[model samples]
Target: MTAPSPACREDVRRTLAYLTAVGYGGTAMEVWQWLYRPSRAWSLEEVMVALDAQVAEAKVDVMQGRYALAGHGARMADRHERYLSSDKKMQSARWFLRVMRLIPGVRAVAVCNSLSHEMASEKSDIDLFVITRSRALWCVRFFALLPLSLLRRRPGHRTRHPICLSFFLSDASLDLRDVHLKPDDPHMAHWLLSTVPMIDDGVFADCIHANAWARELFPNAQSPRVAWYRRLACLRPLSWSLPFWLERVLEQFQLERLPSEIRTRMNGSTDVIINEHMLKFHTNDRRLEYRERFLSLARVQK
Candidate 1:
């Protein structure tokens, strides 16, 4: 389904709603109270007020200190739903995570792609990059995510690759992050910065990724242009696959990860794999890595 423009806000809202339902035992106030980090520095009252705006129109009753997103949020998902990437997808993801938490074996869950800017209008999949604790439960989790993945795929979506990015699912031998993420290579982080939270219990933090780092690495790079040309190359007469050449061109900036976001976008627009957005942001706190790396590199280079 064509994800809506306000998918980010809507999904986040619905996700907060669902998590509020599960996270604090159906306590919307508690969910907000917890999800938003308590900063004694910021105006707590204002934060609570702004969050309350979500329930302004809904029929959710905050009895004592708990509330549900039942009335307004659910109604919007049902009535206003235009695409799977709409707030509905977020609701589905939230529900999926809620279910995961209840499952005895599951460890933690995360929601990536919540803020992805794809190249295609048609999505390839709603990537719910799940992280769990056990290596043996990999198969069990696959079976667990099977029906849900099918259910979560965007409308008109041909593929259903809800990738489980766990050390267990990938390779128990390597660090889970290493197995899921290609490497914390300077090339990758330099480009991505989009991220969101799923069920962060300090196992992971709210992280984001962007393609700006790719631009930084290839300072003279005009990837969006290159992406267009490479896309044309794939369709032109007497052409083999354009990605091979494009990958060669983008080797320095991790053509693999760099193209990931774009490819995911392409899956939306055309049938071609447009390199999946050049970045796949997992929901973790990778904020300082960028700054720290720059400083560390500057020191070494000097």
Candidate 2:
């Protein structure tokens, strides 16, 4: 194959460095999709050629269809095996989506963070990004958490399989800047780009459109491939009214106890914020800290 041009080589270099910084071992296809491009004009064949050149130059390693830094062959292999095992976890997320959608006003459900990027460990909770209808955010959360809480009570149940419903927003609150907490956060940009939408229902598509500013920060980033199974949650006829009344009833009697219950049961931090349009539970602000670590490593690689 002909050698890649200087620009193409730099693109490949940055892509490898970024993925390595995040401890990602990606397939050729993943590398292409995740390539740092202002425009996704590169074909898979072109990406493969560039990867081949990197492997030949000993700048990248390839093992079992996964690619990473040269000395990370074992790590690459392990990541691939974990990715193979990720199917079960993905299915768990899919099943959770099926149940979550039944809750009134739930518009979209997407898996986010590490698992969405196929780098999940055994102890990772199924982190979900839920979009609800306007004005029904808290009510929907009340309903979505009910069955999930019951499922958690089963004997020998694992926390990893349980839904971690920490982030929720109404259709009107999709900008995400309020929760971002920092300007130009690469992790947040990647999170928005990498989220795997399981249930689109037109809401996620709108959500993506509403958050198009992330593209300015992560030009190479693209929407993750939609999940194959688009089956939405089936709702009982009374599901809508149930949550409406439940939210009001809880507000009357259980409101005072709800915070403590959430803390004990969810292991959530005291920083939980509940409002009409958004719910954020990140008491430990780690986005800037984590970004600094990644930037530190990326700088060293330079």
Candidate 3:
């Protein structure tokens, strides 16, 4: 087989390296969809040809229609098991997002992180990324969490499918580039591309457009399309007449009840951000860790 061009080979290697770091493999289509830091846009045909060349060179392995770095075939069976787990989690996420739509001010709710990538394990908690109306950040969060807390579905509840509401962005702060780790943040770029919106009021599209910078990293990646079956219409009428002051009240109430760890870490940096436009409570952010692991894998491959 003919060798892939340098750029194609590097892109293919980088894509596999990142997926391997996350303990997953990719089909040809997924490699194309999650192409990382490509020097330029690459067509699906081109990516397939590149992958074929890598396989011929013993640099990559293809099993059951999935591709991974050589000696990594052992993960395919585990990935399939996780795929089954993800299906059950997705059903739970869809049901939760449906209820979330009825709670006013919620513009969009997306299945993110491990679940979004369909790599959730049996013990994994569902991670959701929420988008709310400009000034309804806290109100939407309070209402969204109240029922989940009551039902013991939130994190720490020991539920089989606990939901983790760690990230929220107001419509006014749709652009997420500011929150990305400095220098090169490949994980953040992929995270943005992987989000699967379950409930959308047009805000998901706006958020994707706002973060056009991701294209610089994933030039060929397209915004994920929410299936017609998964898309739930928002009940805007419920929040239409809500007083603006109510947001402040809810914000204060939640702030006072926040655990000391979160309160002390609030606004310390992007990891535990808390402001009028965004609420991101990732006390143990792993973007940097993932980036380092991906780089280490890429180096070993070289």
- Return the top candidate by lDDT: 3
**lDDT (Cα) of model 2:** 0.67
Q: Roughly what TM-score does model 2 have, to 2 decimal places?
A: 0.79
lDDT of 2 by residue, 1-302 (tens): 77766666666666666666667767888777677543446677777888898899887888888887677666765675566556567766666666675667777777887778777777666778887777676677767777777778221366656567777887877887665645556667677888877766667777777878777655656667654453342221222434456556654453465666455534343245566677766554466765675566546545
For candidate 3, lDDT tens digit of each residue in 121-170? 99999999999888898988898898899999998987999999999999
Residue by residue across 64-180, what tens digits does model 1's lDDT show? Answer: 344444332332322122333433344434445555555433433433332122211123344544433333233334445455657754333354334333211211221222212
Whole-model Cα lDDT of every candidate shown, in order:
0.33, 0.67, 0.84
| Candidate 3 structure lDDT | 0.84
Model 1 Cα shift for residue 29 (angstroms)? 28
Poorly placed runs, candidate 3 (over 4 Å):
227-241
* Top TM-score prediction, candidate number: 3
lDDT of 1: 0.33
- Sorted by TM-score, highest first, which candidate order results? 3, 2, 1
